[model samples]
Every structure is written in structure tokens, then in C-alpha cells.
Target: MWLKVIKFIAGILAIPLMAAVTRAFYGNIVGVVELAGILKYFMWGVGAYIVLHLLFFKPMFIYVLGHEAVHAVTSWVMGGKINSFKVSDKGGSVSTTKTNAVVELSPYFIPIYAIILMAVYFVVAYSYKINGAVFIFLIGFTLTLHLVMTIEVMKIRQPDLMKSGYLFSIVIVYVLNIIIIAMLFSLLFPSFSSKKFFADSYVFSRDIYAVIIRQMFF
Candidate 1:
């Protein structure tokens, strides 16, 4: 009975959480558009996305490995012991003694491949004058890969989300993905700060509340 009540309350909170996240994401995207050379970088990203989409590139092997790895890693972080880990081209899963929403839902939000690419980029950038266009293109390519694959996986009924509660999982995944996208934009354009993004979001949220209050009274 209490669990049902909790889930109902969480579902109610998810609506507002999604709204706030969408507003912040839109504001940051607008900010990114205002920056110089952003269009060219964006084009590079778009081109990369097109190429990947056309190729129907699906790194199921790598994704499966990362998916299970994230489960194991998070479980360990939460002081849970892993009984076994399995991965294949079809799918992957982990067996752990510890289980929670964070552990279950992490892989959906964390882009392990992108993180690997960024780490390699940093190392290469230290030694070579990597072309700006190429760097931006790769970023776009990997990001699109992550986004597309995530959606494809999410289309199915995932046990992880079910165990975590659908409303709670959706809210968490949306918020984390929004924050990650904002961070990626900041990485592409150094001028756009994550701090400023949050500040703008706060202001936007406050204005929205004020408007709602006025509408209620008037």
C-alpha cells in the first residue's frame, strides 16, 4: 500500500521535473546557437550523424559490454558483490547482490563509448594539433551513436526500468540525459558554462511559477 502511494507521488513529481528539464535544455540550446562557429560544428555533427545513420552502424558488442560493465561498476560502488557478468551481441546482463534505482538505470544515461573517445582525444590532443573540424565531427558521430542506440534499446521493455519503477526511472533518465547533453554542448563550446546553464534554468523556472500564479489570481 505504501509502495503504491510512493509510486503515485513520484509519478506526479515526474511531470514537473520533465517540464523544468525541457525548459533548461531549450535555453542552453539557444545559447549554443548564439556562439560563433557553432553552426559549422553543428553541421559537422549533422554530417557525422547522417553517415552513421545511413551505414546502420550498431556497435552491439561494445554496447553490450559497456552496459554490463556499468551495472557491475555501479553495483561495486554501492558495496554490492557481483555474482556474475554476461555479454553478447544480442544482449547483456549482470548479477549483483546489491540493487537500487541508481545501479539499475545508470547505463541508459552514461555514455561509456563517448567517455572512452574523450579520454583518447585528450591524450592525442596533448601530442598532436588535432584539426578542430575532425574533433567536432567525431564528437557528433559518437553522440549520435549514443542517442540512437539508447532509443533503440529503450524501445523494448527493460527490466531495469521496471524494477526501478517506471515513473522514477523515466524522470531520472530524462534529467540525467539533459544534464549530459548540456555538458556536451559546453565541451564543444567552451564559452557556454554549465553553471550559467543551471542559473538560466532557475530563472526560467521562477518566471514560469510567477506566470502560473498570475494566471490563477487573474
Candidate 2:
């Protein structure tokens, strides 16, 4: 029971927590910009949101899809035969008859691919750097996609990894993710630390039912 509880905490904290943090901080800043009598803030916010969701949706989805594909492909490459694979709105799973550290670890190493994509983006946009505001919005989108993938990887695929005192693994994933996010931001905008964003957080999705019930009477 304790093991499950710890695993749940670790898995949830791995990525979703950080993503939630980013949203909270950015959302709050946007709100503050609104309060500062900046009409353009809202315009930029809305425009950026719409453009990001529209233009990047397909590419991000492909990235998300390819992310899982990497896992499956890696498994095959690592001498593990995949038995079954499933993906849905919430999570995904891939069963294998045999597993290796490399295959099992592939899902958590998305920053490697992200780095390559970011490089290509920079090269194409080389003459013009991606602007700061746009970069913030882009990282926000990327982080959200990352959260979804992390939920799939952490909660469903490798719950045991976080539970096994593999604190080193968690650190590695966190640092690598931060680096990739920061670099991607640097390519366009000035970078910010995860700490600057989310100071504290609650897992809203996991507690949505409770939150709804509590807010219903209020």
C-alpha cells in the first residue's frame, strides 16, 4: 500500500506537476499583464493561444504519436518483441515479452528527439529568431504535450521505475526536460527556470471529482 502511494506520488510529480506549474505561472503573468492596463496583453494572449493551438496542433500531435512510436520501435530494436500496444486520450501501454533497460527507458528520453526538432526549427527560422512571447507560448504548448506523454509513460508504462528509489532517474528526466525546454525557449525567447514558474501545486486532474463536488455548492 505504501509502495503504491509513493509510486503514485513520484509518477504524478515527474512531469505533470511541472507542466501544471508552468501553466499556473504563465496564466498568472498573463492575468497580471491584463491588470496592468495592457489591452495588447489580452490580444497577444488570445492570438498566441489560437495560433499555437491551430498551427502547431498537427505537428505536436505527430510528435506525440511519434513519441510512443519511438518506444515501440526501440523495444523492437532492443530485442524485445512487442505483444500489444494501446493508446487513448488518457494513457497508453505497450506490452513486450522481453524488456531491456534501453527499451524500457526509451519513453522517458524524449528530450533527445525534441532537441533535434528544435535544431531544425532554429535552422529554418535561423534568419529570424522565434520571439520571446511566441517562445513562451510554444514552450507552454510543448510542456502540455510533454505532460500528456509523461502521464502515459509514468502512470501507465513505468510506475515501478519511480517507486524503486531511482531518484537518479527522476533527476535525469527532470534535468533533461528542463534543458530541452530551456534551449527551445532560448532559440526563440529568453529562458526561465521551472522554479520561477510553479512554486507549489495540487494535482487537479486526479482530484477533479473532489474539486467539482466542493465547488458545486459554492
Candidate 3:
């Protein structure tokens, strides 16, 4: 009963949360014309993957592989032992000694391929300038792959959301994705400010929720 109420409230809160995050994200990226080249490559990467998606070339096995890997990795990071891992064309699964909201939902938010790519980029970037558009293109592609797969997966009933409570899981996944995206933008653009992105998110959240509360009660 209490859990149901909490989930219900969580679903309602997602509305303001989305609005605040969108504002914060837009505030950070809007009118930052200096890094237009980088943004272009990134967008090109996004569009490229989207085109592939339209053509039905998006690979389900790859996403399923990454999805299970993220679950296994997050489990390990949290001191949980992986029991078994499996991935097929239809879907994937991972068993861990421990399970939590983060473990169950990590695959939805963490683009494992893009994260691996970024890690490699940082290491290689330490010695050599990765100036080619190919890097950004790959980033865009993998992230979109993650996004598209996640959206498709989300449409069905997920045991993950059920374990965490669907409303709570939905809000958590969305907010974390927004934060992750803002952080990625900060990494890609020299002039983009992560601190400012967070600050804007905070300000928007505070103001919007305040108005919402006022209208509901006062």
C-alpha cells in the first residue's frame, strides 16, 4: 500500500523532473556556437545511426550483449558475484548474488559501448589527438543504439521495473540519462560547463516544483 503510493507520487513527480531536466539541458547547449564542428560530427553520427535504424539494420544481438554486460559489470562493482550470463538474438539475462534498483536498471541508462569508446578515447587522447570525426560518430552511434534499444525494451513489461517499482524506475532512469547526457556534452565541448548544467538543473527543479506545490495546496 505504502509502496503503491510512493510509486504513484513518483510518476507524478516525473513530469516536473522531465521539464526541469529539459530546461537544464537546453540551457547548457543552447547558443554554444563555438564547438559547432564537434556538435556537427556528433549529430552526423546520430543521424547516421538513425538512418541505419530506418533501414532495419540495427542489431539486436549487440544491444542484448551490452545490456547483459552492463548488468554483470554493475553487479561486480557493487560486490555482487555473477552467477550466470546469457545473451541470444531474442534477449539476454544476467544473474547476480545481489540485486538492487541500480543493478536492475543500469543497462537502461548506461550505454556500455559508448562508455567503452569514451574510455579508450581518453587513454589514446592522453598521447595522441583524436581529431577525426570518426570518434564522435561512433559515440553518437552507440549512444543512439543504446537509446533506441532501451526505448523499445521499455515498451514491454520489464522485471527490472517491477522489482524497483515502475514509476520509481522510470523517473530514476530518465533523470540519470539526462545527467549522463549533460556530462557527455561537457566532455565533448571545450566551452560547455558541467557545473553550469547541474546548477541550471537545480534551479529549474526548485522553481518548478515550488510552483507545483503552491498550486496543489495553497
Give candidate 3 regions above 4 Å deviation.
Answer: none
- Report the C-alpha lDDT of model 1 over 2-40, residue by residue, as the tens digit: 775686688665556567767877766766644556467
Q: Return the lDDT, model 1, position 93.
A: 80
**Steric clash pairs (candidate 3):** none
Per-residue C-alpha lDDT of model 3 across residues 1-218, encoded as one tens digit per residue: 78767877877777688888888888778856655667787888888888988886768899999989999999999999999999998998998998887899999998889888998998999999887688888988888988988888887958887777777777888888888877876887766788988888889999998998899999
lDDT of 2 by residue, 190-217 (tens): 3333334333234432455455557887
Scored by CA lDDT, what does every candidate get? 0.76, 0.52, 0.85
Worst 10 residues of 1 by lDDT: 33-42
Worst-scoring 10-residue span by lDDT in model 3: 31-40
Name the best candidate (by TM-score).
3
After best superposition, candidate 3 residue 139: deviation in angstroms? 1.6
Angstrom error at residue 63, model 3: 0.7
Ranked by TM-score, top first: 3, 1, 2
lDDT of 2 at 194: 38
Cα distance off (Å), candidate 2, residue 78: 4.5
lDDT of 2: 0.52
